[model samples]
Target chain A: MSEHLPQAVVALDVGGTAVKSLVVDRDGVLHRASTPTRASDGPEQSFAVVLQAVEAALAAVPPTHTAVGVGLAVPGTVDENRGVCVHSENLGWTDLPVRDLVAARTGLPVGFGHDVRAGGLAEWRLGAGRGAEDLAYLSVGTGIAAALVLGGRPVVAGGYVGEVGHGGTTDGDPCACGGRGCPETFASAAAIGRRYTRLTGTPVDGARGVLDRTLQGDRTAELVWAEAVDGLGVLVSDIVRVTGASRVVVGGGLVHAGDALLDPLREHVRRRLTVHRLPEIVPAVLGGTAGAWGSVLLGWRAAGRGDAATVERYAELHRARVTS
Target chain B: MSEHLPQAVVALDVGGTAVKSLVVDRDGVLHRASTPTRASDGPEQSFAVVLQAVEAALAAVPPTHTAVGVGLAVPGTVDENRGVCVHSENLGWTDLPVRDLVAARTGLPVGFGHDVRAGGLAEWRLGAGRGAEDLAYLSVGTGIAAALVLGGRPVVAGGYVGEVGHGGTTDGDPCACGGRGCPETFASAAAIGRRYTRLTGTPVDGARGVLDRTLQGDRTAELVWAEAVDGLGVLVSDIVRVTGASRVVVGGGLVHAGDALLDPLREHVRRRLTVHRLPEIVPAVLGGTAGAWGSVLLGWRAAGRGDAATVERYAELHRARVTS
Candidate 1:
């Protein structure tokens, strides 16, 4: 507990196919490692793999660093207050007491939360959404989802608040969620690739390939890309109107398309709004590391040092690290 | 300042056509009055009418009652923190310093807020949404709007959070707000009547007439009514997925149809949801007076007596009054 000791924490961001683990110091420096989640191994085996990843990160922490706690961000429905993974469709977990198990195994206090929500927190505090009190982080990746930060706190809502992907944006498109016309059915990165392939009866790498084909004036790719952008516009416009978010930070794989995605999407959303305060739509700067950084912040809060000053100091360090 | 004195507040609910004024005691017992807003008289004149209504409510307060504060709820965009009415298209007001003006005129502390938000607060605290930490009040009136109560507090995002009416639901239907395919263009009470009339080249009273005609097996009426219900279903389903509200209280004119509106809406939204929490949709119990009661609660908060116990006592009184 010496004041001179450099504070560090074990942070893990567990996704469906991969787990990212990091030893994050208070200076916002990251020592990183990763492991395949092996979700197909089933819940118990995947849980064991998660623990191994955490142990590896813990082992990497230098002896000079003081390890205070562990922070975990997992995908799917979560009850953060109760520290339970309520249900994760991809991970095959149901009502797992993840926090208690992690605490018991690591003998460290655990701060558990939803991955997207934690990512939103990181972006809100230190990335593109910084300085905005009301913001939304929309991740358009394998599947579309959003994380809402309102009044400076991430809205958990029993881990169900950010399912905008399930909202209807079309008339009859079939969705994997067993619903029709869902935004995710047409707007997600997976959807763009799948739709283009289905229309042309040709294999494509993913949304990236679809975008490249569209750039080369491929009719089917252009149509698919246009539909995805339109669906995204409808969804984001609805979100802005409902939440009064002053800004929306777009992230995930599709964002790599840069202005090709942003410029048209912004114009479409702008045209949809009539009386709402126009939100500044921008790109997320933290890229794929938002969840890990957010875990560090969560660990700091768990250790009782997550005041405004501490957060600002860490944010400055993060900025310096990224820029350098 | 006497501990033995009963505290009361003057509360006003201002709309485009009329203003409701009342003297509300700490127990939520209300002595009410009304005045025509005459907004066509222009902003200054309407503002004068508003002041006159406040004075009338203050005059109605019993001499033994201690009027410590005032609460005013008005339609359109408001900045509650700055106590300014940013704009009210119906009232023809912009950048009006409503709170300071009321405070100066009445020598009382003032709580100013958006009408829909205040109404939502009342419903969440004392009406159908009672006991739900996350709830939404959807008002399907002349023009549709909503009020969101999240985590037991009204979300006031500079008076813009609940503009779901302006969100698109169809491909192209002109809206007064300059947007196309807005929910209000299809689902609002006015829309039902106007669309029915436009389709049949016949005039109808309102949504009630449309419902009555449908019950009588009128084909055109059935078509219009069905469209309104479908539009409402889409909007509510989107809202449920985005906000994760456990319940939604349907209020305003359309709820008067009761089961006719609620039954089909419940079924439609249920069909649209997949892997998301299904919200309980119910009629708002406070009817049209929700806004007035909400203003009283705002006044209570402004007077520094808005603890949970105090709120509960007021809620009981409100329930008794409404039931009686």
Candidate 2:
């Protein structure tokens, strides 16, 4: 609907561990630059460091780039439409004017979005969920979160769709969200490690060590793994009942366990949901780069370059970048 | 719009114990007729009886109708678009070709819909949910069922909604649906009477006797009542979680217990949901007549009569019926 503007946008994906930045042109080509998050320094200092990374990424861009716009994907709840980080417990943030702050520092238009939901959008459009209309992407990293895409539009569900953290667990497990019984308290990668440590008084690195111990015939590790699977089953059952998703893409840090996690979680859900059709649970194809790719996609859409007509423009730009 | 048609559509609402027939003119004036369902006689005998009732209601019309279209509402799971009764445990139906059978018999276009969902549509458009866009209506009669109206469209949720009967209870309870613990196994009006009969070793007529006994400080009755309230609370909490509804309209036989049932159930849901916004739980405005009124509204919409635009047409039709 508007004239095509050949511009490169700055994309930032802020996770608990690191901040990933990319200078992406109208094409989906990424000139990547990443740095340690250092979230302990709080929002002010970390934001300054993020600005430096963004500036460095933008400075690398060619002279053809004009009017820099930034797309940010941040972990935790976001008032996305307003470009504010409402509350990101992992980042020690409360009502931070992130987009405004970034804009003030970089003097660029910013688009803000929830990290998992933005990743889900990328998965739905170009990754695992490509050509699929109705889908739910469950990213099970430090915590379990979901993004439901229906009719190509995500059902905000009053912003409760991905708050799977507060969904009740079988037993009363403590959650940081103040809920005594939540799926996240039992099934998250953090929960797996916590449970294993609590059971055997052996502090493991994360879910990977817990799984390793279980496979090595550690009885306590086996019990913790079983409970984690059961917690996941409840979440999967509830999602199937409410969202009617035909396909679910599962991703995140915990998925590193791979078939060990997938096999049992799938079996448990199949056993519980006897009445309805079960959706296929598959690993995410986009992997670690999903959020950054999603941020770039968001920027492309924001720049009015997301539609049937623009696919050719995208292809041409992508080809030119590859040839160059 | 096209020129106003003088034709009247026949609306049949078939419940477990009753069959209600209405000759609703284009404006939705119901000339009502009814009879016992006699469902134990089986679908064949009962369907024949329904046809006769429809014919009689048609004969009672002041003016012989033009091209007739019939809208029939039935209890249980249905393929609404296909006009097939996929299954009705109450009606002893399985994969019944209801639309084709009725259409063949009546020689008219037939529209079939799930009774609860159709009733919810009626309520959302012309009853309790008249102005509200997003609403969830729970009907608790012989069983407990729910209907979600979102943006004026009743969500079927893969045809699993309105099956609140299967929602498991907090405490284990016997349910006829072959589940160990189900909401309807304790909270339904049928459950109240059954619980009373089991406790006293005497046949209590219905929910009213149990309510009366509870008022009289009968320990058995009080326990039963509390369990029912708790069961209902779990169902409502799950509904609130999935739909994010801020207002719930409850109807059916159990709701007649009034504040005794409503107050406690509301309090339980409020206490359970700490994180999500609590919805207002209120009695349905449609009362016992919701089904019949909803049938009329369904016929009205099916006949291309708009609620806001058909005030004069509705008045004229009402006057015509009154004089005739």
Error of 1 at B176 (Å): 1.4
TM-score of each: 0.97, 0.81
lDDT of 2 by residue, B74-150 (tens): 88777666677878876778888887887788776676778887777666765566665457788888888888764
Candidate 1, CAPRI quality class derived from DockQ: medium
Q: Which stretches of candidate 1 lie over 4 Å from their true place?
A: A1-4, A321-324, B1-3, B321-324
Fill in the DockQ of model 2: 0.23
* Chain B TM-score against the true chain B, candidate 2: 0.87
lDDT of 1: 0.86
Error of 2 at A311 (Å): 8.3
Question: Candidate 2 docking category?
Answer: incorrect
lDDT for each residue of candidate 1 in A25-67, tens digit (9 for 90 to 100): 7665658888899999899999999999988988888878878
* Candidate 2 structure lDDT: 0.72
Per-chain TM-score, chain A, candidate 2: 0.87
